[model samples]
Target: MLYWLIKHVLLGPVLRIFFRPEIEGKENIPAEGGVLLASNHLAVSDSFFLPLMVPRRVTFPAKIEYFTEPGIKGRLKKAFFTGVGQIPIDRSGASAAQAALDTGVRLLREGNLMGIYPEGTRSPDGRLYRGKTGIARIALQAGVPVVPIAMFGTDKANPIGSKMWRPTKIRIKVGEPLDFSRYSGLDGDRFIERSITDEIMYALMELSGQEYVDMYAAKAKEQAQPLPDRLPESRAS
Candidate 1:
């Protein structure tokens, strides 16, 4: 009820008016059944826009911090996220990856559309990064097809450090679902998981037309920061 209200009555109408988001190949999404939406992470708005455009309720795993903070502000934040249908998963500890995978598989098995970012984190430089294998693992375990979704212009609208969204044209391209039924029993195989993840990334690269970086986005972000002591290059010849 809250989800529908927010998507339709409250936030959705406002976003649609300003951004005027567009979508292509939306028919590729399955009409029914459990499926995984494997999307490239760009801006934070990727979560908001994708769900707004899709017909069904999309559930994404949010970091546990969003729900576990202290005070009244934290309580409100937790309530809002929970009301909007996000699952909280601890992104710390050794079991984090496995816990997330389990959450996705369970959602898929329950006939829900589970949205996942295979790249694990937002791209620091707007290029498609190598995908983590957890998405592939979930797909194989859930025995569902993976639909590749590419988001464009979201970074411009809601940039990495920006607090407010600007009115930028947003576009979404949905690629045909990739079926890995051939590898039905190969979920636990690391080699197969990597292969599947690579294939999904390839599809996203083609759809988004972004340069494919063979590194994880989180690592790229870490390497992109300049040292505090580094001096600016001299302009003097």
Candidate 2:
């Protein structure tokens, strides 16, 4: 009920009036099914714009921090995410990763559309990064089709760490469904998982036209970090 009210009666109408997102390849989305929407994460707005444009209710696993913040502000944030159909989960370490995967699989088994960022994190430089294999595991475990989606120009609308969103034009390019039925019951194969993940990343690269980086987005961000300042050298020491 909250999701419906927010998407249809409240925020959706306001966002559409301003952003006016252009959605292409709407035909690619299945009318009804347990499916995976694997997308390239570019900006914070990707979550909002993608859900707003899609006819079906899209759910993503958001960081538990969004739901656990303190005070009135935190309460509002939690309310908004819950209202928008997002599931809050821990995203810290290996165990958390597995937990998130389990959550996604359960959602799919229940016939819900699940949105995932295979890059594991947003592109630090607006380029596609190597995908994590969790998405493949979810698809294979749930026995669902993976639809590759590319969210364009969302970075311009809401750049990384930007609190305010601009009314910028954006496009959503949806690719055809990728079926991995043959890989069903083979989720334990790491090699097959990598193959599937790479294929999905390639589709995203083609759709978004972003340069592909072979490193994980989070690792790339770590590599791009600036080195700490060096202390001034003592004269003739």
Best by TM-score: 2
Compute each candidate's TM-score over C-alphas.
0.94, 0.96
Error of 2 at 221 (Å): 0.6
**Mind giving the per-residue lDDT tens digits that candidate 1 earns over 72-157?**
99998898887667889998876897888888999999999989999999999899999999888999999999999999999999
Taken over the whole model, the C-alpha lDDT of each candidate is 0.92, 0.92
lDDT of 2 by residue, 1-237 (tens): 898899888998888888888899989999898989999998988888899889999999999999999999999999999988899989889899899999999999999999999998889998999999999999999999999999988999898889999888889999999999988899979999999999999999998899999999999999899999999989994
Candidate 1 structure lDDT: 0.92
Worst 10 residues of 2 by lDDT: 13-22
Error of 1 at 50 (Å): 0.3
